[model samples]
Target: MANALPLVALLVLAGSAALASATTFTVGDSQGWTTGVNYNSWASSKSFAVGDTLVFNYETKAHTVTEVTKSGYDTCSEANKLSDDDSGSTTVTLATPGTHYFICNIPGHCSSGMKFAITVSATRSGGTGTSAGAPRVPAMASVVVAAAAGAAFIKLALL
Candidate 1:
């Protein structure tokens, strides 16, 4: 019985840690923007963590989730790339644990509030943590709302 006590305690602790660390965030198109949600703009609760995947749902207008850094923080900007807008949606896996700056590269959209921020937390769990977040992901039954009609697709050269 004495040996079993210690083993049981270890198992309990491991389970608690897993419960606390597992999480996922489902990001979708913005509603306010006539151009639709340009970048990492979700419904609300603008925050996220590592091991989480940002699901960019499609709309009639094509948009991209372009990772970037602030004007003075150029280091992060170096490794950033633009995800192609196919299937009207896609998912970008958050690999590193840090503040990810993103914006819509669609013409003047970024300047028009088509930008947002996501914080990726670094919890020790097989590199990529489980997808978890508040306001949980939406059900599959709902249709994605696209940008207002006549919003032309803007093309820009990525950095």
Candidate 2:
């Protein structure tokens, strides 16, 4: 029974680390997904990870977010698009590690520099992931672990 306390602590720490791995990023920052701004520069300034999310905020009537292939992105082609969203607020999760491309499908939007490509890394440990804020689960887990440790200590004292 005494040996279980150390094992529990280890498990709690592992869980805390895993919960901190995911991150969310607001795409384009304050300017958001829109025209007249340099999307390329916005993308270049940030690092993306596989588990991170990209949130695109824009005016739905004036713009549409389209996920496209490399070829489609290059030619600003809307044909054979992978996905399209005009919700004004689109949340895209980077599920895999690869080069993902997005563009505004509104006529000349893509040609006018409304396109950006982000390369997501496979692992978050390469200093390529953005931390939106502190991981909530880690803090909660730490508190729970501390309580458990206290209980364990009390039980040992009683024994």
Candidate 3:
């Protein structure tokens, strides 16, 4: 019983640390997923790692986020896109370490500078922390952490 408090505290802290490690980057940073913004250049300024996320915000019907292979990206071809979305907001997690390509396949859109490539490296030893201002702990996780803390306190008091 005496050892439980430290264990619970450690669990809660570990969860928080995991959350802190991941980053959610908003593509184009206010300019959003639209034309005229240099997406590849935009990506160059940051370091991408597996587990990081890219968020594309745009008009619902105006553009589409098309994930494609290297060839597809080079040709701006929509024939074999890996994924496609036009939901005004798209969130994509970097699941693996490699260069991923994205383009807005709306005819001239891709040719007219509406595409970018991001390179994701394997996760680093230490977490980069949530630099994009995403919440570290979810609401449910917070509740659980609070309950565990309270129980630990009660146990310590009893001891």
Candidate 4:
């Protein structure tokens, strides 16, 4: 009975910790290219989880979170998407765990310092040393990464 109690308590604590670590972040804040935008520092900012999905909500001006490769840094690359001018949404799921580079494919955007980056960490397994896969965490943490600088919400999840 004593051993069982300790085991149960540990399980409960682990579950709670996982829930707390789960986070969500908006892709685009309520601002234009000037200030108060999410993309401004997204490159060295945003975060990701194993099964997290990045929700790109386009509010104004056509934008996209296209995947790119950091010249010298070797990490995960390739996954990307372009925002739809009409509905304005581009969702991409983080299947593997690694760092992903993203930037606006728009002309003058990337050059004008309109670059974004995100780090996707391994998902929290369900006790068996594997990710719990909780529908993707909104994001892992907030770093120097800037926002999209448009009218949109780039949500990162941890699944």
> What is the TM-score of each predicted model, taking all chains together?
0.48, 0.74, 0.79, 0.46
Worst 10 residues of 3 by lDDT: 129-138
* 3 versus 4: better lDDT goes to: 3
Higher lDDT: candidate 1 or 4?
1
What clash count goes with each model? 11, 0, 0, 40
Q: What is the per-residue lDDT of model 3 for residues 1-159, given as tens digits with 9 covering 90 to 100?
A: 766667777877776666666688889888999989988788877777777788899999799999999999999997889999999999998899989999999989999989999888887454453336653344557756676778878887898
- Prediction 2 global C-alpha lDDT: 0.81
Number of clashes in model 1?
11
The most accurate candidate by lDDT is 3
Best by TM-score: 3
What is the full ranking by lDDT, best candidate first? Answer: 3, 2, 1, 4
lDDT of 2 by residue, 33-139 (tens): 88898888877867777767888889877899899999999999979799999989999988999999999999999999999999988877555344345422346
- Mark the regions of model 3 whose C-alpha exceeds 4 Å error after superposition: 1-5, 125-144, 147-159
The residue ranges of model 1 lying beyond 4 angstroms of the native Cα positions read 1-21, 28-47, 72-87, 124-159
The local lDDT score (0 to 100) that residue 118 gets in candidate 4 is 68
Q: After superposition, how far is residue 70 of candidate 3 from its true place, in Å?
A: 0.8
Weakest ten-residue segment in model 1 by summed lDDT: 143-152
The per-prediction CA RMSD against the true structure, in angstroms, equals: 18.4, 4.4, 3.8, 15.7
Higher-ranked by lDDT: 2 or 4 = 2
Worst 10 residues of 4 by lDDT: 143-152
Q: Worst ten-residue run, lDDT, model 2?
A: 128-137
Q: How far does residue 134 in candidate 2 sit from its true spot (Å)?
A: 5.7
